[model samples]
Target: MPEITYRDAVIRGIAQEMARDNDVVFLGEDVAKAGGVFKATVGLYEQFGPLRVRDTPISEQAILGAAMGAAMTGLKPIAEIMFSDFFAVCFDYIANEFPKSRYMSNGQTKCPLVVRTGNGAGSRFGAQHSQSVENWCMMIPGLKVVAPSSPVDVIGLLAAAVRDPDPVIFLEHKSLYATKGEVPDGEIVDRLGTAKIVRPGRDATILALALMVPRAVEAAERLKAEHGIDCEVIDVRSLVPLDTQTILASVAKTHRLFTVEENPRLCGWGAEIVSIVADEAFYDLDGPPVRITTPHIPLPAADILEDMVLPTAERIVETVRRSLQS
Candidate 1:
């Protein structure tokens, strides 16, 4: 097994898919010669060449539009929207075009494309650049949403997304780019709509995704050590075809549930999960499900304010402890 940073895994994932499939192509701003704004795509340009790996102009609309065209025309294209928030600019493609293409055409057409973006806070990029907008894509009926939390997942899920026969939103957390993890050698491909129980416990279950995953795990460890409140921490790797079975089973065993989300409290993905639990697994819960989330407001630029606004491990510990005690 080799340990690698999440950033390098991005490069390897794209390279692996592009190498295996000639139909796979990548395009985005600064992704070619500059290796991306975050330097995550270094060596791709030289390896794949200009035709396969390209740099696009500064327009999210043009980026996704071209990607949709390429996908519909039998090319598997991976398009990058520099920031996930910019999806608002190309809502038509995401909301109407790419997703509905195959269905609208009565399965006569297929749009197999991937929209990857830098998502989530922790870079102090302020409100516009720091949103965890997986919730936005998850709401659409035809889209498959994926937010990978580790280096291995970044590779495995990216491979899976590239090969799928439909549109996929692959969210890469900006804050997690530097984190390192162990990845087994070989061609790694993972299934979509699966939740991983990173730390298993019997008292409660804490659901989180992307950057919130590590925070929830830390909080779970602290709670067990200090308060004897063991918690099962589940990394919700995929949100669209959500693994509700895993979530419900965890809640059934633990009899308690809590969600830690980086998205704002209003309409966050956790709200949907809580609703599902309440509707289907309400009797299994010993207490009301709790949601620990960022306040419903635009993110602040100041480091102190950003720290206070995002859901922290300390906040998770405090919230879980207080809720259980009450």
Candidate 2:
């Protein structure tokens, strides 16, 4: 049980998948020679060779379209959109082409493609490079969106995404790339749509995704120390096929709910989580569900403005406190 950085774990998962299946190939800008913008695919090019690990052009559309074509013809293409914001450039191919091809063609074709991208706001990446757009993909019908918060989860979930039949949007928070955590030595595949309860408690349930999980956990620890609140933290690892049952059950026991996400408040993943809670666990909730998220503005370039926009641990704690009070 060796501890490794989240970036390393993801690289290991991709390397292992490539070794296991010759059909599994990685395509993205800088993926071949530079080992990816974040080095998540380091050493992959040398190990798998140029044919399997390719560096594509700057166009996100071309990258996605090539992935779709490769997937439809039998290869499992893992295409990387350097940043989550750039994913918008490939929306047509992702939402309509890859996700709908199988159904549109009467089940004659299957697009088992995994679109990997970096998300979240940090490191002064400015507004354009640091947007969390997973919610947009989650809105699509056939696309499966996943955001892993830890090294262990990232390794396991990426492997699962690669193996799945449907097109998967695998979002890794750029800020968490260097964060270290325990990851199993061998290949590990986390089941899709499963919500992991990181911390068990009876006072309230705090659901978080991606980097927000760590923030929620920190808030939970502070709540226990300051307000004597026992908060259960649920990592809704997979966003699209959300694990509503686990969330509802946690809310049932805790009687209070709150969600933390990096995206903006309106029409974001937090809204979707709140909607699910309202539908399935409305009566079970002792108070209104709260969402700690960014404001409905573009991610700012200034550090001070950026800090104010993104959800913080303090915000999560305050939201939990408010939920408890209500």
Candidate 3:
């Protein structure tokens, strides 16, 4: 019933889980005393104390390496990567170690590790800081990838991620950190592998993720108000165990599909969503599937360059309008 920021919702989720379980611990650069770079973990250090909420060195490999070890042994560790782009620094450890532990150990070991990272562009954080690479984690076999668009989702998905018995890439989009939404009262943990229909319509279906979810809904409203093109907007919260059923069901009703994301056009998450729709619900679509995404280039720091490269509501409206006409 009360509106809260996405950042606060995340902190609540972590704190609730940590209070509920002693095995839960948090460690990352600036996560304790500094309270996280984005302030997502503020006030946690004092409440949980230094042992549970720790600040680690700025080494992704070392941080994740320690988290993997802790998770496998007895604890559920939440390791923050600061920026999603830094995951590359520890990809070898993730690829060769964390994800493979369960199978390699023949189910003798479980990796209940959750890596929280700030994701997406639109903050003008430049090429190095701005990237929507959740798709990379989705490609991995043993990892679960989930991105939250609203405050409710941040709390629900993060809570679920903390309790899951495997590695989870929990993405918090930088653009949506300040975004506010009404979160339900009490403990609510939305299951992984589920999608939500943010807006219902009849003309077309717009499938979006993370930061693009709000943009898609905005585009849908504009399309309806100005152009009379109603649209169904879907928030694909969980990427790894994608909710293909929800996507197909929406496509069946609207008869058109469009995928939106901040990631690059080539091989991005949007591409994967559209491909699945095309492959599974081929006959249900009235037009060819469309993908609205950023250009296949580094995100620029300049506002104008970023705007031109990024997907906008105007672009989404136009894309959906053109799809209907064709």
Q: In model 1, how large is the Cα lDDT of residue 207?
A: 100
Q: In angstroms, how far off is 229's CA in candidate 2?
A: 0.5
* Candidate 2, lDDT over the whole model: 0.89
Q: In model 1, what lDDT does residue 103 have? A: 86
Which candidate, 1 or 3, has the higher TM-score? 1
Shift in Å, residue 69, candidate 3: 0.4
Q: Please name the candidate that would achieve the greatest TM-score relative to the true structure.
A: 1
Taking the tens digit of each residue's C-alpha lDDT, what string does model 1 give over 1-326? 79999999999999999999999999999999999998889999999999999999998889999999999888999999998999999999999998888788899878899999999999988999999898888889999999999999999999999999889999999999999999998899998899999999999999999999999999999999999999999999999879999999999999999999999998899999999999999999999999999999999988999999999999999999998889
- Candidate with top lDDT is 1
Supply the TM-score for candidate 3.
Answer: 0.98
Rank ordering of all candidates by lDDT, starting from the highest: 1, 3, 2
TM-scores vs. true structure, each candidate: 0.99, 0.98, 0.98
**Residue ranges of candidate 1 with Cα displaced over 4 Å:** none
RMSD of each: 0.7, 1.1, 1.0
Lowest summed lDDT across 10 adjacent residues in model 2 is found at 317-326
Residue runs of model 3 more than 4 Å from their true location after superposition: none
